[model samples]
Target chain A: MKNEWPLWEVFIRGQHGLSHRHFGSLHAPDAEMAIKNARDVYTRRNEGVSIWVVEAVNVSASSPEDKGAFYEPSNSKVYRHPTFFDIPDEVGSM
Target chain B: MDKDLFQYLLRLGDNTLVLGHRVSEWCGHAPVLEEDIALANTALDLIGQTQLWLGLAAEVEGAGRDADKLAMLRDIWGFRNLLLVELPNGDFGRTLMRQFLFDAWQVINLGRLMKSSDPRVAEIAAKASKEAAYHVERSADTVVGLGDGTAESHARMQAALEYLWPYVGEMFVGDDVDAALVAAGVVPDPASLREEYDAFVGRIFATATLEMPESRFTHKGGKNGAFHTEHLGHMLCSMQWLQRAYPGASW
Candidate 1:
């Protein structure tokens, strides 16, 4: 049998209208099975009302090895910090 | 005789206890770790239900007996659980099939019992029904997954269905205790719920690309005081040994 099915990342919403939070991942034969496996794996305690499963191969992310270059520059951008502004007393009171 | 009520409660309690014990056997042996945890968690839930029901049974008996005494002291013949639960967990598929059938029945049965005239029974049933619902859903999902996933899984699931199908009849076989409860509105007729259970299971099987096994020989003995299966003895031995060895000992 072909073992080429992609890994899927599972995200679950705890209750209605909630955003799906990452739960875990599982290997599945297809998108449908991915969702079903997610339900079995993630929602056994009635912990979720909704689930979203995306193939892991389809997701792109910055490499951890590049975190220094990708994130350190942003950390030193002081103007981007909202705390740099002093609010007027009237605005603070409001 | 009120002993009848104790007997009735024992039947309910033993079914949960024995089945919980069987499911617990899969704690680390399940096909996957997630499923192992799920089955173990469900086993704990069933054991909790067993404790509550057995405690209530002790109260109703007025025998100065507690749940532990009743669970651990009784002989196998005194146990009144349906045979379905005592049947060994044959394989992963078989176990899932057994859980699927029992959980579905329990959800319906417990739902009706929540309206029971007895306040204690109703309260426990209400709480248990929620847990039972989750068990049913998870098992149903497994049945669907195995039935449709791979050719090997489909065959295993079908064989499991055949092995478990005979035992399903005993679940809705209303004994005198059940009849009285039904008459008193303490529980709905198990027979009435059978159709709904079948339809629900049928839908899942249909979607899973599996055929529901045709009802053939109905095995009827566990509730009527017959024990032909081998699993229950070991289960009872392990479950009852501690309490029996140290009678009246408690933390």
Candidate 2:
């Protein structure tokens, strides 16, 4: 049968205080079912306390063909690294 | 041994066991990948509950049987599941329709069972209730989505509801065994759950745009082991074949 259902990307919060991370994608009739399907597919083993599902179509991703233009320039900026900053011991653990 | 308690436990366990097996049949065949996984997860939860209920039943019986034995060794005449659970999954709509009907009642029943005088029953009910609550939410949503969605889906959902409604009455029907349990404070009377079940389903049906069947006629006898639909026997044939063919077989 043709899968007319829309594809959804699933994210899961593994525990309290954790951010939901991209886990996988699945087909569902709608967002409600997408979350339910996410639970069954990715969180069956108590892997998450929260879930978020968005339609795959809604997400805007950079094309792999533009990978050099999108990411290569960022590598050339060394000041972007926080490691270059010196911190006093009084600002402990920073 | 408390015979009444044993019977009551069987009633609880068999309902999950039978329905679990039925839902598991969708493992490879559900209409969509998401739904297939959802149905399998639901089946796993029911089977997990079955272990607890039937495990307690075996202990009460004191006849050396365990949960696996009780589940796999039982014949059609020995099962105590409501007939509603054993019906074939005619289609996705029919399957979820049956699930919503059963899950609605099961969640309410499990909620009340959480207060049972028997600590073990209460503990099991508490754990199973969590899963039942989720099951009901999903099933009810699906029912509404399909029942109100389109011409074909709406028609199918209505037909599924009508086909499954007659079998639902048996869940609330009780007899001497229930009386004994009630007297001991081990559980509530089955009939008492009807009002809440009606109100719950009524609201969902309204949203789903499906009319409730006017007929109140109920099919009975599955819980008491007095009678069962022919489907149960055929189901058990496949479900019990390995155990029956090789007694005491195990991994």
Q: What TM-scores do the predictions have?
A: 0.85, 0.94
Query: Candidate 1: TM-score?
Result: 0.85
Candidate 2 true-interface contact recovery:
0.94
lDDT of 1 by residue, B42-91 (tens): 89889999999999999999879888888888888888888889888898
In the range B49-104, model 2's lDDT, one tens digit per residue, is 99999999999999999999999988888999999999998999999999999999
True contacts kept of each: 0.06, 0.94
Candidate 2, position A30, lDDT: 86
Worst 10 residues of 1 chain A by lDDT: A1-10
Error of 1 at B61 (Å): 1.4
Model 1, residue pairs in steric clash: none
Q: Judged by DockQ, which candidate is best? A: 2
In model 1, the Cα lDDT at residue B80 comes to: 83
Candidate 1, DockQ to 2 decimals? 0.24
